[model samples]
Target chain A: MHSISPADFAAILLSLKVGVTATILSLPFGFAAAYLLTFKEFRGRVVLDGVVNLPLVLPPVVVGYLLLLLLGQNGWLGALLNAVGVRIVFTWRAAVLASAVVGFPLLVRSIRIGMEGIDDKLIQASRTLGAHWYDTLVTIILPLSFKGIVAGSSLMFARSLGEFGATIIVAGNIPGVTRTIPLAIYDYAGAPGEEAMALFLCLVSVVISLAVLVLHESLAMRLARRREP
Target chain B: MKLAVEVVKSFGVFRLAAAFSSAGDRLGIFGESGSGKSTLVNLLAGTMPPDEGAIFLDDECLFSREKGINVPPEKRRIAIVFQHPHLFPHLSVRGNLLYGYKRCAPENRRIDLESVAGILKLEGLLERGVNNLSGGEKQRVAIGRAILSNPRLLLMDEPLSALDDELKFQIIPYLKGVCEEFGIPFIFISHSMTEMRLMAERVIVFEKGRIVQQATADQLARLRMPTSQVGYINLLKLGPPRQVDGLYAYSWGGGELLLSFPVRRPDSLIELSSKDIILFKRHPEAISSRNLLRCRVVATFEAGNRTGVEMDCGGERLIAEVARQAAVELEICAGGELFAAIKASAFRELG
Candidate 1:
């Protein structure tokens, strides 16, 4: 194993930061999307479902390109942000955005499955009991889908840690600002006589992924135990 | 609750067109599966929208396609005890019971959680999670939850269909007692004639998505006797039993009934199938049946291949089914005397 450098350590910390930020920001939106897709009937439902899942099937590089087009300087969203004296492109925020967009589908899909498994009669009972739809969602649907939320969050966080193609395109790989562990590993693998450093970063990625999976499994087991007799 | 409903709903080839006015507190919607009983419940509870129709409860318009007045389910204040318990799995027994009570409007709330829990006998199980509850206990919690909502009308959609015979009988009392104690009118939905008779005073019979008949629950039972596999069930309420010879003797309708099954309750209900009674024009010297009641023929009605002999035994009314040929042999007529023989083992104890 090679000794860790300042840049490598920054990469590890930035990866954790981006993963946490992205997961936290996407939680509410992902929950809403899942609820809408699973429970409600509305026009353009199928289209919304397709749009939410497009990122999952599309290549990360392609998604990165689309995010670049949507948030780049001359883009409508970018122009609106510029009016407010804010810049998203080529910053750590852009990297978080890139990771969020790439991992959103997985989160929504998991939560949607959880919501769909709920018995229809239970929802009907809640409504007839004088609970409005939102009240039922908060009390019944949210608590029932806790396992799915935990699982999805872990998946999205893990995905964000490995996010590289989209971050490099939209956030432009800046060593202390936007470079994550995967990006740092890519830089080391491309240099001469830096195989050991790349291997060390690869070991770090494995350890983080394993830790996330173990945490997810423990959470899911606890939930299962609590739900059973 | 006086409910007037004129609703139409369709799903592909099946269309439900039902209209009726029920003023009774205990109204039974009796129908077999796919006969639109559940659909009507959904429409009345505001869970499903009617294509075009109107619904009024106690002269208050709940839905009117012409007037564009459609109240959502939460605002309608009609709660249902579904076939399955359907208790919120994520909640404890207490939480599930209070889920609706907390949301109920203050002025509308009449029943409190403590009272409901007492009525349903759910106090001990309140803090426990719903997952471990027995089927009967879970159903009690479901009933408690619905009752605590303080709705004007309770819709029981085949609530007992999911339980075994013992559990079904156990839950029926809580269902009836809670509604009666709280003064909440209910519409009981079921295909079981016995259940309908026990729960509802008046019944609306549905067949193939239409209202075929509206009559008292007993009338409906007698009307369908020939077609029903179990025939007409004669529900009898008897006083506490005394041991006589090897059987339990119960003082019944102006007479005594010897039952092979012993019951310990002060007052017990027993059911005897109409086919179980054998009528004889003359008292036979050699008869194996234990009880012989001399009854006068009140009226005779023809039901398919059998003649239903409506007899007045002392002051109680008992209907006995006999073959049409046997009826002619006995020369059965109104206001005529006849001997009805029944075995001690024929009486089945009920909850």
Candidate 2:
């Protein structure tokens, strides 16, 4: 194999950085959404649930375009942010936002399953035992559904690593600032006489995804065993 | 605990409208499944709010639709022991017990973990995980956890209904003893008449979302004797027995009674069905039955097809059921003398 170029190395590092940053940023909001969807009763709950799950079913390109419109330079939110001198479009932050929005439903769905599996009686027992709602949420709900959180985070991170359509439209294909592994691969595939480099990056993607899935499976098994024994 | 509840709650087709007050230290909510007993418990514990009306615990308003006063379960200080143990799987036995104790307010914290563990006989299992404990031990830990909260009232919602007969009786002592020792009043809920008799002094019976009866457990038992499949079980507490000619003889109120079941425990409870006792006009010359007592009838009540004769033999009370025709032929009356015979195999040890 040909020695890897510096630009490719930067792409690889940025892919991992964006994946990690997106997953971390989405954790609290994901948990909150899952908690509300699973436990709370309110008006328009079904509507809120439908909205949360929209990005999962929508095409990635359409999601990217919708996000572009929402955070464009002349958009309301973008203009408000510009008043405070902060830029989000065509930057690494835009890549993070795009990845987060696309992967959010998966995160929320996984955590919601975990939260739903918890017996209602356990929550009632905690309350009658003198735990306030927030106290019970922190002590009981959070710990009991931690496996779901971990699984969701891992799945979302893997999804973010492969983000393409959204990242290209929102973050653009900058060499070091915004281009990730997939974008780099797309660039190499288009250029003549760069098949080997593309194939090598493809191999790297396969390795990273496999490692994450295997780690996720092993962590889940370990959690199940610890809970039982 | 003095609880006054007048609440109405509905879930689709089933509606619960309960209104009652209880001041007893040990109160039993007796009802069959789907009788709204659990709904009443939820309302009392503040885990579920009532659609209308109010609830007062010792005259302190816990919930009131008119006043817009609805105290949450935590602030109500009313703990519950659910049918299943429901212990936190991540926590050890000690952690589960202290989960409530740590949350209790300082001034309201009267029972500590040590005392709860000691009372529930959970000292050795404290460090062990809750998943590994036996069913009875898990229930003991649950009761201990509830007690450690130092709640003003503990609602035990069929805590032992999930256990087998032997385990049910074994945990009854811990359930009763823990509450008594801590001076925490509790409402015991169960469908088992035996459990109600053993645990609660006064019972509020529920039938189809309504309070049908509120009376002593014994009175309720007698009232249902004609209809119950097991007619009026007479619970007898006897001391350790001595072996006599292949029979176990335990002292009664002031006399001796022979039973076939051997009881190793120092104090044991035995049940004898009312139908097991036979009445005779005079002492027979020879009989297969072992116990023959000279007794005077204290009272006579009409059971379904037979008459229940309340008799006093050697200062102890025993009810002997006889056919109405035989009662009339034998001239069975409140002040008449009669002879009662019971076989040695008739007694069954309960706990």
Candidate 3:
């Protein structure tokens, strides 16, 4: 029955944008990493897996600091990109990048499990049937693991929507620009007479997380049915 | 078309050294468990590289150690179906059938979806999701998928080994028709002699990572080898001339015989009932049957419901199966001379 303030609405839209952008940007890399980890046997596989999982174990601020070091103007990659007139720090895009980095571990882990659950014989059969490696991956492996991909993406989106620490450190919570729902909630909770708005945002976050969980469960059930003889 | 493969591989303690060549013919690999039959299939499929060897398809070198040429599976155009049907779980039966079909060379596509479906009896299953298929249905779809790819060779690694006998029987006629229609060289791996008899034109017996023998189906059936810690039975093959002077000599064993009715061409392989043969302590006269051999029992062993009596008759070794009760009633024992009376028609030739 209560109307949302302009600021609160902008924060919700910003959160959606950041979450969707983060999920889309991270998907290809997540799939590649997961596929490599699941199918390839290499000398540095353990190291690669550990590195991809680092964001999960490290403090959010530490991930943000690492991102800053890599994307900062004077940093190696940052300088190269700056010379091309590209900027990532302290921007909405930077928020998306931060969210992606923090959410990548979950996506890659889920996708890896999905890819590993596939029958290797299926892939071999495809190959013998004249499909090249890439064709087999695209047509056989990816489609067969669709539920896993959906589940991973949904979890990543939900996680990115709630991202606070890494986003604050990297994009700096600028109002009407980089500030997301979680950041807005933090700001409103700090100000007097903003309790109602903060509660509303919190409730929205809960709803989104619940929706994702339900979607994941349904997808898993469908997959289970598909696997039944 | 011909396939020549010679490969040697070692996996920790398991070693595999397989070598064989076939000229557009079906070759069956026979062995017990752990004999590396599947390993040979994998190597030929190009799924795994052999430590040393060469593989040639006709004149093309698929894999050659001396030349360092190893064509990947995709380029080899050889399709393999594993013991477990590996249909794509996410695809419908039709989609699975087309998955490989689309990737093959357009000009090389010799088999169409309709023909493949007809061959495997997959037309009714085209719209169904692969996940809901029964084991036999899955295998049929898998075979259909492979055939649609227009592969030069088809590798079946115990494709029926996972199914029950009834299901196997149900699908065998379809498989036979496919082979006859296409004349595609097949390398079928199986431990079941019955399956080998049905599917393979030639048999290659494997023992301990090596091919012990390679012969035609008839020769393999007649081969007498030491059975593995178990009893060995030599199969007697009976050709045409079902009636020779009103006496059809079906099988001569242990100087004994049983009468069998004449069967038309291509009868199902029958397991001759050992109990059917009647053993007489003395040669019986006035019998209409013509086959009667005198022999002495060399060994007598009781097996489950029947006693296995090994007898030697005029340079021929025979095994007669007699019920325990009959053995007791007749007092049949080792070193006892007995007249084995078998009707000319009782011999069932097994290939």
Candidate 4:
């Protein structure tokens, strides 16, 4: 029988918390960006869309470096926060921010595709039915794009769980405080005679990724059925 | 409830320019596809902004380029039902219906959920998911949802065009009842003359993006068909006449007209064409005709003097065609009574 260490178990729980927080923080902004990109036409729209997707093409380390410059204690935004006595650097919240930055592109892209696939006439009909923009979004757009939201959140959570480069650079690996599962696995793998613990963490990551994938596929299938005329 | 609109907009290569108005009435916008009917509805509903012009619903100006006023769709107080019902897939029938009502201001609320459901015959569907509804059922739910919003105006852009004839017929009465009960002004778009006759009291003909004609229902119907086709046929007031049997009899001009041909279904209204009619000046002495009526022409018209005359015999009217020379010789004119004859086979059943 394999025994799991308390520190390793704490890392798992912390990883879940980070993944969930990142997903929740990014979802509303992701939906808004996706909807604007898919439905509205304005000057510089293409530029805005490209910017939202920058995190996907740029290296995770680069994203973390950018975050550090903007959010570190002596950084521009960090200076303003320090004046107000609020700190975000080298904390669990910083890990969530890094995860969200890396996962945003994926979340927005999926939701945009889902928004584009919806029938425009349906939105028009809702407008004619006396619903305003916010009402229409809540009642029509959100409900219809629910599958995309679920899929995007799942993908983001899975990606955040495995986040290593950005999290390491921004939050700095600290056991029991900031060290998530992926970071702990990296730390264990670096030490001599800790190969078994590293392997166990890797196996756990694979299982989580697989489960999320299965759940996403099932949700997507159900949404497809509902869309059928 | 007057609705006046003038809008000009361009989308890529498609340019739309339209202007028209209607009082408190059921006005139909009739045109072929790509004639900008849907675009007109969109403009009216405030979904698309017009490059120029204004729309006034009664005294409230919904949109105006001159005044630089553009009300958003939610504040327009208008309801629209598209050809596709567009019910929210995640919502049940009840949820879909209640969505608009919840969004409306309390002071502006006029329709209740129960009343809308009852009017649209949607009581049995409240608990069902919108995704599970049939084509007709979805339309009913869509209508109910729109009504519950307490809209001042209702726009229907070919709402029944997607359904089959049977379904269209099934749901049309409910729609008509909704309009009548609420006294809400309706701008209904349709291509079918039959549907126009069934619902609209006024008609606005569209050619391209321009309004060609706007007339009352009876005037539109008269202008649509030739003068020869405008007349009353012998209407049989049936009281549970034979079930499934097509044969029936009705009296007109003190004569019996036997309907020997099986009507297939007699529960619905039927229309007949004027071209199928054959007229005679005298009662046929010898013929296999199953239907014949003796009557006098109350009115007549000269169809280039070639077609003899259109005769109104008692309450039934029939058209007879004769040579131009024969019309001068017979001396047929208005108020001249004449014998009109028809063969039973000429009456084709239109359901």
Whole-model lDDT per candidate:
0.91, 0.91, 0.80, 0.78
TM-score for each prediction? 0.96, 0.97, 0.81, 0.86
Cα misplacement distance, residue A136 of candidate 2 (Å): 0.3
Kindly report which residue stretches of model 1 are placed more than 4 angstroms away from their true locations once superposed. B264-268
| Residue B145 accuracy (lDDT) in model 4 | 83
State the DockQ of every prediction. 0.81, 0.79, 0.55, 0.49
- Identify the CAPRI category of the predicted complex in candidate 3: medium
Cα RMSDs of all predictions? Answer: 1.7, 1.7, 7.2, 4.1
Model 1 alpha-carbon miss at residue B79, Å:
0.6
Per-residue lDDT of A124-182 in model 2, one digit per residue for the tens?
98999889999999999999999999899998999999999999998999999999999
Give me the displacement of residue B104 in model 1, in angstroms: 1.1
Off by over 4 Å in 3: A1-4, A214-229, B224-268, B273-351
Q: Model 3 misses residue A199 by how many Å? A: 1.5
Model 1, C-alpha of B202: deviation from truth (Å): 1.1
The candidate with the higher DockQ, 2 or 3, is 2
Interface RMSD of each: 1.3, 1.2, 2.4, 3.1
lDDT of 3 by residue, B59-138 (tens): 79988888999999999888987888888877789988997789899998888999889878788989888878888898
Comparing 3 and 4 by TM-score, which wins?
A: 4
Of 1 and 2, the candidate ahead on DockQ is 1
Residue range A1-229, candidate 3, lDDT tens digits: 3368777778888998999899999999999999999999999999999999999999988999888888898879788989999998888988999999999999999898889888889889888988888988998889777777888899899989989888998898888889999999898899888788889999988887897789788988877787653
